[model samples]
Target: MASTWRTRKADQKTNLAKRRSPNIAEVSIPTHFRCPISLELMKDPVTVSTGITYDRQSIETWLDMGNTTCPVTNQDLEVEDLIPNHSIRRMIQDWCVANHSYGIERIPTPKIPVTPAQASEILSGIAAASRRGETTKCRELAVKVKAFAKESERNRRCFMSHGAGRALAASFSAFAAGPLENSKTGVLEDILSALVFMHPLDEETAWHIGSPESLDSIVLILKCGDLAGRLGAVLVVKELVSANGEWVEVMANTKGLIEALVKLIKEPIFPQATKASLVATYYMVNSDVERMASRFVDLGLVPVLLEILVDSEKSMCEKALAVLSGLLSCEEGREKAYEHALTMPVLVKKMFRVSDMATEFVVSALWKLCKNYNEEEAEEGGRRGESLVEALQVGAFQKLLLLLQVGCSGSAKEKATDLLKLLNGYRGRAECIDTMDFKGLKRPF
Candidate 1:
């Protein structure tokens, strides 16, 4: 552990350097948002003397609720982060309520495969070679790492997990920044690929997060402000928590994970579509539910996500709708979801807007969202309270029924039937059933 005096000494030296510099520093706005508690222009912008100042109050709320650090600062920021910038607190409050998702979710980066072990072994060998002044060996090792990362890309591979991928990517980057690079596009491409692989995309594949080594690597990876790298990492952390079902006890350990995940909103490499997708995805990572209903909720995510949900691009729409379904699922499970859910309506209208593969993925996502409400939450299966049933009653029911008619295998047919049966058992469900005309209801025991 680092000692306090050491930390203080470093802080003092940093202050001295800043004071010694000829130019005064510029106030840093997080490039991301207006203030939340008070949505004004976030005037009381506090850039720490140490050069890291996030709105303390916002960071504090996330932490006092048992989070470990500020999502923006990755600092030891706790409740003190909530110390309001008294000057602009009111303005910040207004902005919080006014800002919407700008109709974009920076999409999660495209995924790649390179194994953590493979990347690690190669980077370590290069680092050792560099230390020994063996430029030849270092260059050779970098070549191998780049080649392997490239090969994994060719396979259109999904990463092992976000943490593992990022850790591996960080190591690769250290090698690239130090020993590799010559203004060549090929070298630049390798760096970019490594960036994507640094953190796997959310649900690009299932997240496997029990590995301590992978987690450690993830912490190292978050140090670099490469926007794409951190965005991928956040999705992995958020999705892993999502995959864990409601094990909030296991989730407290992931506060560091959340901080890394939220930090992406401040970076530039994040596009409007990708950013919206991430907020929708990560916002759903709260212990049991997504925080969409909170008074302090980040509403800036909504409009952007809605845009992608309606996009003409099949892959983009598929991902957007998947995030929407996850968001809608959380809302639907509770009766309160009525005020916030727009996903089902948008989904129904855009149902036929894409390629069959993308359509299949979206339908599968919708199915899982419904399935969780039906099968997993059984005893609490107040079908009346479920968002899935509510969606069925509105407009999306026909689209789902249409999906059932598609020429898929018997298993797909069976799953759809099972979901239908769950909704059918609910109190005002007959009205929804009346909307679908699939008459061949053969009972599959």
Candidate 2:
């Protein structure tokens, strides 16, 4: 009877022990389960070429920071060297489940990663659908591509490596050639959004997108599409135009392309859109300076650029000045600039206040205007001195003198000196002296 009573007592003690919840800190986790890099339990273990396993996040972060060697083994490692260790991940999940009472949660099984082959297959489907004129199907496949890209950085890299950019550019070119209706706008937007995922496009892909049909489609989107679509279109244009001079010339001559870009600058939907439009315009005008500048000037680009210079931030000021400088290379551009009320004053204000680049552009533009004024004065028997006098009226002399006082780039220093001589010629004029601030004036030399 005493033996039976002892057995019952032991059984009760065991039940009580099972009912009690132990603190997680008391559990001894296996060392092998921890990632070598993070020294924590590996959620998604991956083996590298060095035959060492690490948590995927930990090693990817290491590689992204430009380390080409394995953290544990010091062997050369590349991103493609990573291989998922499924057995270890499953073991981790099982361990967490068994330790549930200690507050350990089981890690969910990870989805199979995307591969380059899979990305290429989806792109092939898109191309086939585009060829068949199945707009809806093309859009669905594009969404799938975009979904894959959005899933992870690995997936994006996979898609980009598999010619996703060229495929999407072809698909865009195909659909954009059709009639643009509300239904088609969704299709185009999906394609454009996916294309944006494949950015920093290769030259071949850019060549495809720089076609006349693609440019016309981009212009339409810039005019009528939603904000995201417009931004994507402008950004794509910016990238394509930068690819080659031939593309730049093509974009410059495309009907309504420059006008659409200028409109975006005039009524900016966002800062990036405005900047991208400015960059695109700069490239287009710069390609064929004399002809392209006249086209942009006809679109009232000069006044809009002047407005950006007057009120926008430093970066915008710099880009606006760049476009203005290119535009000033043509006679028509110079005339438009001279006619604008804010041109001289705004240029003077931006000097040394924005950046070295901005100062250079400003000096170049002013030199053009003053030089033109001198030519006109000689041709028209010295009657067209108003622009030169206006430069002095806005304190151009003082700014130029100060620029010379401090220092500037080689080209800017030369332009500033020439401008000083021009302004000095007009210094004794009544309009200049009346508007000049003489207070605290001192010669730098």
Candidate 3:
């Protein structure tokens, strides 16, 4: 069936070419002057092992999409090699120039494709630099690797298949552990940025590079490195947590990882770094490790998150709110959040201030506090009542009522309704409740 289809296509192309040439007096380009695959003028013409010439992109698309037979010949391709049809390409260029009055533009020469061998040689050089602690050489080679990989899909696959990804990762791990005095921290950061750009690399290679020692090195970069380095390290850590399955827990337990992340959150040199730190922290806290979640609270992350919320743009606000929501899932997290002076007001102020997502996170967090803190716990000397009283005193009940009146999301409205009920049940005719005025309730959304 496939052979017959290819034959039909070839015949159709031939017929089209014949039809196009008959009107040449009207500036009609001969169909044979175009690639059969694209039905357009060819650029970067190359012939396959099947003796059929095609535009390089069109043929590459054919093979990349899993077709092994030649489009024009209907013959099984003997090899995957593409030999540049320079003679034919030059002819196309000359014809275009001759037809310049007809609005034809000559095709410029295409860049020489990087061979797998060239990419492999660069990888080998990077590995050697790793062994010799040659930071400058490693940075230069790392740049070359990134350049080649960015040149073409074929170059990227070549690097992946020929072990360039693994080699580069190994080199990163080595330099990450080397003496900081020997190499400028910027060099190490460049190597890491190279890895971040070549993501979804081999899973085994990812694991080999994301070892405990390497993770510690990355965390160190997060703590004291330059802004770009900090941003790159966060991305690298995000990738490791995603690719390395159970290795996430390993990273969560890495000695200084959490503390470094918290510090980054508190004093992010760049906005992207703060966002990435929030993501990295989200991953670790989402690991569902009890001790890990508590440690975030212990490190005073809640208040830092609170501070971040004050000036955060919508996206960052959402993430900070989410982390707060997650932290509130446990007793320690709740205690920390309720204890913070700005927690209630910030949550209230951001209720309708940011996006729907931010509102949802805020509502969910407040609901967690209201629903979970019980009277029995209050009788036992818990701060549940105190927190609730604080919520009520700060017009939390009024905000809940306003949320429902001014129209929030279905989920937010439901949570608001429940919170109003919870607060009303706890304190009848609460002092703050008398101040509620439905006429004044208004929101941008």
- TM-score: model 3 vs. ground truth: 0.67
Clashing pairs in 2: none
Give the best candidate by lDDT. Answer: 2
Count residue pairs with overlapping backbones in model 1.
34
What candidate 3 gets wrong by more than 4 Å, as runs, is 1-62, 69-113, 150-154, 176-180, 184-187, 201-203, 310-314, 340-363, 376-445
- RMSD of each predicted structure: 23.7, 12.0, 12.4
Which digits, one per residue and each the tens of the lDDT, describe model 2 over residues 1-445?
A: 9999999999999888767767789988899899988999898899999899999889989998999999877999998888999989999999999999988889877766787677888989999998887889998998898888887777888898888999999888887775766777777778887888897898778866777777888888889888988988898888777666677777767787788899999999999989989988888888854488888888888888887876788889999999999999988888887677677767877877889999999999999887755555644644237667767777789888988889988999998998888778657773544323333333222
Residue-level lDDT for 323 in candidate 2: 96
Ranked candidates, highest lDDT first = 2, 3, 1
lDDT per residue for candidate 3 within 350-408, as digits (tens), equals: 88788878888889899988788787876675777677776786678777787787787
Q: After superposition, how far is residue 141 of candidate 1 from its true place, in Å?
A: 8.2
Q: What lDDT score is found at residue 119 in candidate 2? A: 80
Using lDDT as the measure, name the better of candidate 1 and candidate 3: 3
Which model is ahead, 1 or 2, in terms of lDDT?
2
- TM-scores for every candidate against the unseen true structure: 0.37, 0.75, 0.67
State each model's CA lDDT, in order.
Answer: 0.45, 0.83, 0.77
Please give the distance, in angstroms, between residue 429's alpha carbon in candidate 3 and its true position after superposition: 3.9
